[model samples]
Target: MIEDKNQQRTQLSDLGEFGLINHLTEHFEIKQSSTLKGVGDDAAVLKFENKKVVVTTDLLLEGVHFDLSYVPLKHLGYKAVVVNLSDVCAMNAQASQITVSIAVSNRFPLEALEDLYAGIQTAAKIYNVDLIGGDTTSSTTGLLISVTAIGEVEDEEVVYRDGARPNDLLVVSGDLGGAYMGLQVLEREKEVFKVNPNNQPDLEPYTYIVERQLKPEARKDIVQLLKDLKVKPTAMIDISDGLSSEIMHLCKASDVGCDLYEEKIPLDPQVISTCEEFNIDSTTIALNGGEDYELLMTISQDDYPKIKANPNLTVIGYMKASNEGMHLVTRADTRIPLKAQGWKNFND
Candidate 1:
């Protein structure tokens, strides 16, 4: 019994980063001709009729990705789909189908699963995506959800992270940083609950911020709107890892640079107020907080008027020569170096 127990206790840390990736893929055999590529790029590339398809997945684990104390099951389910769809939209493709796999502890009853699935179905209908298949499993700990979304686009219409050209205008849809600030509010409420178990947290005032955190919408409409307007993004990425980190990704992949205008960073008023309440810099939160699920893209300079004329888009900056580096021009008329403060799960 002792020997068996010892053999089962394999620490994940023993295989770090590349070691883990190699270990996970070691036994996986590519058995399908349709799987043109797998597991080694921004998105899995697949060859189809006369077009290409991209498939990507994301996993969310309770306690790590979310706290059940504040996150309702329904909202959690909706968010899982939203995050995966964001990745599909990042590649400038229409997300058509998704498979949702979930593992939950026995503590949750059938009704709880129904609540979760309700949100999933709602998202499917809203995004006009189909739910093909998935699996359910039992877990001894908290809940785990893994979602794989499949999308397709014509070969030429597929905008990738590596295609930004110099002189392209950088634009973002909606606002940033509200979700991060909303998280701060939820955490504070959780702390308060710990101190006074009977105190019902008054979160009525933080409706916008709370909603931003709990239920983020993927920019599917933006994709359709852009197409209707005849605007083709040179390169694109979803702002799931914060603006600064994503900008760096586009810059590195395109071998270009960016100069973002701080004054132009679209931020919600509630995010600004919440940042003030928490004594956090709104600009920093907007740049590094992540999880806004907004679209970040670069368009040709000639298309600037198209984006400018439309109220839905904001021109934050533009791509430049690689040697220029990424800089943020503040409203104070000062230029500051942009830094990527993306979240590191290892620190947790």
Candidate 2:
């Protein structure tokens, strides 16, 4: 909410467009053999040889998708790449390359972009992906990032949302609802800061939820773990929207319904406690709270033995005929129709 008046700031105009791009990307190293030419060329050149390729792209706006007051530029940059890569992972593929493009207002200094690129570089190194090519330009808006991620997978291993069948088990990786609760905490703190600038928020109790909102990691490891366990999902989707909407997506795509057990939906202790403090239902947050980024899929019942003992996976329900309809089976033995009340930007 406040900027230091005495701190130095460098304008972006001093380096121009090309120079700025070069300066930001100079430290990015090419780690993938699939990348023939990266960064400097007219366009990135990639050869996947005999492997099939998967491409996923996402655009995030400043005001619409993020708030600079809360989100650090580095985390924003890292998250922009991770979100796209998660889509590739949803297809059961190995992420190999990414192209990052950003539009920013002249108010951003060159150092600010350095922080953003540093985060991008860190993600590239940590995820073992190559930063190939992208474009940068001026903008009237605060900041926006567009990332296109490229991944490689074998033809037989590639999974789609239409492969789920009746009698398959619904499973999810990691927990849910933490990210939404984290956002709630941040929003509350932001309001408090507005009232009193000297009031420093004590976020010690909300550390898990805050990190969930700020820096979310894609489930790339789960993809590899599935391969090692010799279990391929029948239908898969990342929980970017909300559990209900994503579940509905899978059901519609595969033409099958589901009976999601409320008790079985994985949620962290932090989420439950925060929900109590805010007077919101934990189950509702788990269903409609978006940005969990966990993997949700249907697995053949025969393959259930493989993932059963794994703590990372949970079997929450089973798929049924579409005529049966989608419902959430409550703890008291009530079956309620599921609804998509998650993040719908267009509605706003």
Candidate 3:
């Protein structure tokens, strides 16, 4: 049993499925106008008026996608929502509502589930999204969370992976490699704890990166920033599967090639230092380390000046003709084929 003395631990069987759902979701109030009907329904009813609705779903498993030893249930719930919202934002839309479903083993108490919902509530409040509907069920193994996010955008404002054109500038929002390096630090600490269970890890130095891994926010601001700047991305995708893999996905979908500059890829100072401490290449980490939740997009040259001075965005490279192929130009001036080594659930 997980230790929590303040709250009384209750068994799942005591409340039953419907009772448990009501107890947990009682506080979640519908805040979106599009949500015509939310919880306590056979299915959620939504109305989008003249706007185009965007929907995305993601499933996170306990051992495969996350480690409970180092991860908090609240942070896990927030992340589960954010990852799906990131997908909706990738399409340049404003997320309005989310449906969360969880499968949990009997080992988790009602209090533990409350902690998880607390996180879900926090994220909903911060992102301004409503918890429209969801389901809860029993699991024999561990915890699994599935979130489906719904968003809205005008038909003209929506961006897709296939809309990029040749000569468009490749821009990325915020920094990279920090989340991947943060995972490395957490994994190392977990190993240390396994060997000596009493060891107290000084995680202060790795706080930024660790938080980047554990509690990443989607790039919702980038969408707003783009709108404010009156610039529309020709193509866009969120960096959930690492920079290299996501870039390749854009290229393939748009039928174009790219020249990603290794020197130009943004890296946080902590990521660089952590890479040195671990003797791992920072560029490789940036390329293959996924789950940053930042936005990667292509913009026409005409729109370049608008974003040129923006500190939150970085222009890393440019789209090329399909014949050029996708390659990364290293700091040494050597060109290598860009490769995708993003997260693979099957391999895990």
Candidate 4:
């Protein structure tokens, strides 16, 4: 995130609020037919006559949610949108539109915001979600982004965290631990840069994990894949706050206990190798390392056959009676109580 000494700087106050909004949102095209009125209005207009709608909002602060030291504005913009879309995907819904509101300090220039909006537009186009409406205002803080994602789902197709039942098979989309390890790599490089500014980081070996942290994609495909396979999840939640934390959330909401097999938790080769390099336990990283953005779900045993061969999904474990309690069935055949030690918003 190095800045050029001679780079052009167009002041935000010069364009004014309305001019800035219009300039930033001018290039965003409406992709969803449901979006009747997009940017330029006080509030967005959307229509979903028969289908059920799902709305999710996420607020990302400058220092709290992201550190601009290593996080690019464009990547931050894209990540802000994807995080909310991941929430929609967890509901088994099709994301149709999003309203992005940003608050920035006086130090930011118009071109910097253009780069941020460029990432937002790229995400909107790739996800096929329309940019509806939002508010922009001056902030004393660095930068804050709040994205509200709206999605559509069939009335009966909508899944919740409480639909899981005893004996249901636990499933997860894609591998874990990469994002957390990637963050470790970035944080290390950031520290290194402080000590030696001219020493360039050799991140070639950590490309996969690094990308997993910087440009993670929401598992929107898993929802459609389940529909195509005629497999409806009994319960669903996206893996944002780590696997153990999300599993506990699902289990508590469903009034059931889970046996998350340690052996079954998917770990990419890069994640495993990096964990060893860091001298950190891979299993612990998989359990507590947050922001995977993969979908975690439960399905009936009857539906297992349909997804058994699919490479996109991995059957991790099974649900049990609530009295049995949530636990991790270790590789050594030992059972231990599962704990929620992932991301805490109010942590001091």
| Candidate structures ordered by lDDT, highest first | 3, 2, 4, 1
What overall lDDT goes with each candidate model?
0.83, 0.93, 0.93, 0.93
Q: Write the per-residue lDDT of candidate 4 for residues 17-102, one digit (tens) a residue.
A: 89999999999998788989998766878899799999999999998888888888888889999999999999999999999999
TM-score, model 2 to reference: 0.98
Candidate 3: C-alpha lDDT? 0.93
Task: For model 3, name the residue pairs that clash.
Answer: none
Question: Candidate 3 residues 1-348, lDDT tens each?
Answer: 112454677899999999999999999988999999988989999999999999899999999999888888899889999999999999999999999999999999998899899999999999999998999999999999999999999989999999999999999999998898999999999899889877888889898899999999999999999999999999999999899999999999999999999999999998999999999999999999999999999999999999999999999999999989999999999999999985677775
Give the C-alpha lDDT of model 2: 0.93
**How does residue 135 of candidate 3 score in lDDT?**
96
RMSD values, in order shown: 9.7, 1.4, 1.5, 1.2
Off by over 4 Å in 3: 1-7
Q: Clashes per prediction?
A: 0, 0, 0, 0
How close is every model to the real structure, measured as TM-score?
0.85, 0.98, 0.98, 0.98
Predicted candidate 3, C-alpha RMSD: 1.5
